[model samples]
Target chain A: MKNNVKKLSDYIDRLNWEKAPGAAECGELENLYAAVRRVKSLKPPVMPGADFPDKVVQSLARGIKRAKSRKRLLKSAAAAAAVLAVALLVYFAALKDTNIVSAMERAYGRVSAYHGTLEVVFTSGAGERQVQSVLDVWADKQGRYAIGVLEGAYQGLMTVSDGEKVWQSPPGEGALMPVFSETHEFIFELGGEIEALKAAQSARVAGEETVAGRPAYVLEVTPQGGLPYKLWVDKETKIPLQKEGAMHNAIQYTTRYIEITFAESIPDELIQVEGKNFREADIGEEESPAPAGESPDEAFEPQVRVEVDMQAEQAQQIAADSGSSPWRLDPVFTAQVFVSLQISPEGITGEYPVDYEDFTIARTDGRRMKVQVSSDKTEIKAVYLERLVRQDETGIWTVVGYDISR
Target chain B: MNEEGLKFAAEVCRQTWEPLYRYVYHKVQNREEAEDITQETYIRSLAYPKFREIGRAEYLAFFKAVAANLVKDRWRRNKKRGIQVGFDAAANLAFTEDPAEAVGERMLVEQALKTLSAEQRKVVELRIIRGYSVSETARMMGLKAGHVRVLQYRALKNLAVILSKEETSHEE
Candidate 1:
């Protein structure tokens, strides 16, 4: 009789799912629809080395120090590791048969936004690095609204999200450089929603586990999306403890929230800050200063800056060819100084038709200077020898080096 | 793996390896890159002495955070060089069979998910696909178990409504 009931329930479940258009499409459902897909091919566990003992001792020492210094008054003089150990021990000891999933949900429902300095260490394929941030995270009563200010290694970046829109300055301002999504919420929650990578295509749930001493459900979600992120959620607290993924543009990251505390007393000042334009500051830093008397009109108007560089070999070459020309000056005796003039934005301020081959100067808006030469390695090569000056985006003009063919 | 360490590693690996792979594959859209990152995640986890002490939630959270940062880094480098890597490599490994069907279905689901709130979508994913026990799903989402169940029910109903609308439109 009981088996029949279970069968009926299963049938209903299948029927309900089939009827729901809201269900993943037939094609989508098939991808994730594999029944009883066993998770095998386990990589033999690599044991923590003898170094574990020492590390554990050190961790204990650190924990004690932290407990002593903790201002919250909730933590005891116990080691942080010990605190975690004891919590897990107590949880297991009391409710040996308790349903972990239910306990977790009850605790998670109480979750609220936390604000504090969360020292985040980021490792990537390139190298292992740390990003220590004093982050201020706030969520509305509904837990949908959130905003944070992260101060890491490079610069301070703000993540303002109304449970929706998020924006930040480029990393030239010393923050995580933007990629894929232009916003923080989009990037952070890729595992949650953004399906461009086809998450459901290759996703599965692993068994139960514990995080931060709280029993947590393990969801092994692999998406057809190129990059996969592992999510470990506390079954008890329903908070995320560790997230491992690609790091540092190239390296992988093993990000863990070591000491997590939820405080109801997060002052408004903690989340609030002076709003300043940081992107502009960074752009200003990269830009060159504008030259004096270089008014916009002067920049637009035509002006001639003639550059003359003496080349003896070129003189000799010109002299060698002079015998074929009507001009009577001995090229060998005359200094073949390569003279080139740059035209301003207005138009050709000046032009010398004689000495140079195909020598021409043209001007265009934004780009004022142009050099033209017909042929002859000597003149063509000589024209490129002089250095050039350009005004950068910051309205500053600075000398730029040029490679001259010898 | 020490008894404790072994259990922790296995649990952590089981919980995360899939999502990490998916997360990396999606962002980098390359299998070898995703695999490399996934393997690297294990290596990094091995380095931490607290691996045994780590809670599953923290482990997964750390993994996602790391993967997200890596994706950003790769995205930046790729953008600077203006190179586009094909999604074939990652997609191939992700859907061992039926790539087209799998990808199409996932796209549809994700498209629909986007129309919902992030919280709602998360609830749906955890409840519907991963099949987390109600309490467990709530804990992972950091919401009350009741809230998780309530949200799951509502999200599912809404999704059903949406799917029905889509079907009707298609018929038209």
Candidate 2:
């Protein structure tokens, strides 16, 4: 046992000789220790629920039998399969760089790269004007858009855009990601969400059509999964518009480019929207921000972005518990925000106004935001954009961007 | 394949398959693929003569090396076909209790994990999650114990730094 330990140590040392320099003794030491452990493990433990080794041995025996036969059979099939599969793979690989794909990708890129702010208005039955502010714009190559809506400005606040990933207001906002956007493109007011519509297990290019007074190609896209999307593309500009998806609960998007302009000298500032708070994006990392001055409603628009982390409250709580502010959550916005709070850290110390969600909450250290019952409901709805208000330390108040449906 | 080589491969499957399965389960988060790779590791070990000379620790080290290679290869092949590879949808649904909190932690861990190199990530996962000792880890990963310690330090430092930066940005 002593000798084995020394050998294992030696083996371990040799592996790190570059860093440790000249550790021959260590390599042999590791080898000996490894040998001892291996031998010890060979004797199965007496404990209950220890069937792994036996099962492993049995499985291996079966695999050996199967592998031999598989090799023999595959040898014959591989020759034919390799020829066809390789040819197909290469052909598809080559097709990726074609004009058709480029046109489709360009359309998708147009939507994904769109950046600009627009206010969406939903006039309710009572002529009550509700305005929602949109931020950060980007679309996918498939013409799907992800947009971020200002949570405080909208009640039951959430952002919706078309893409594989759907973004919603972070938790504590009582907002769940709406499912309609997943099935329909029109629900979010996105135009031309799909670029290359695949049908019958292939990309389908439907004949020509006219869209918004522009000559366009109507492309039929049938996805193997999810609802199929129908796209209309501008023939001259190679731009697409009006992508409609879903058959059962069909959603249609009508896009009228009110105006189209391209600038070769694209300003970097146009793409950057300072102070926009982005939640965790549904898309993976390397998610592109929206392009400059483009409507957020364009299909494949980039998701709404916020400068502050959404989980600021949880992080604050952790810090409070740990007795140190190891983490801080601050709201980032280009514009100055004014807020009034109902709750405060020192227990109902009245209200004060501040700009941006993170800043407002940071002032109070995550105190609850509530609407006082004594307040007139109608007046509250009309004046205050949000329903609840909370204040942190430093006497800064934040509008609680949450839905108070009840 | 040599007789000893096949025996070593079989022994490797017997000793390391389950933990390996779990390790891969966390990375790709798929049971079917994890099982498939676990089986493949055994079959592959037979092709290398070094298998006969290695013990449990060395065998584990070899298997992990192969598993990492397979994962990259698998991802590339799937990507070529436009198939996105990552966590399975079913895995997300399985979390019913405190789903919000669980999801948050998972995202944080994933974001943190992404910062480490493949080798560093593997060492951290094995030593931290699998509870492998320095000695055992060195043997299984075929690294010197000192190298494992250095990798561990780098992994932890990277995670701490990344998390801290994110927190600072939030606070600001």
- All candidates' TM-scores? 0.26, 0.24
How well is each residue in A1-406 modelled by candidate 1, as lDDT tens digits? Answer: 2333232222223322221111222332322222101100011122334344344334434443444456654455565668788889998676555443334445545655543223333342335343322233444333232333333321234444333333344334443222111113312231233232232355334667754334555655454533455656655455555555533223343444433546563455433333643232221123222247665334333223333333533442343222111111111101112332222223212232223323432211222222334444333321221111222211111111112334
Index of the highest-DockQ prediction: 2
Model 2 misses residue A396 by how many Å?
42
> Which CAPRI level is candidate 1?
incorrect
- Show where candidate 1 strays beyond 4 Å: A1-112, A116-120, A124-136, A141-151, A157-218, A246-250, A262-406, B1-172
Highest TM-score among the candidates is held by which one?
Answer: 1
lDDT of 2 at A393: 25
Q: For candidate 2, what is the TM-score?
A: 0.24
Q: Tell me how candidate 1 scores on lDDT.
A: 0.39
Q: Quick one: how many clashes does candidate 1 have?
A: 81
What are the candidates' C-alpha RMSDs?
A: 28.9, 24.6
Q: Interface RMSD values for the candidates, listed in order?
A: 19.1, 17.1
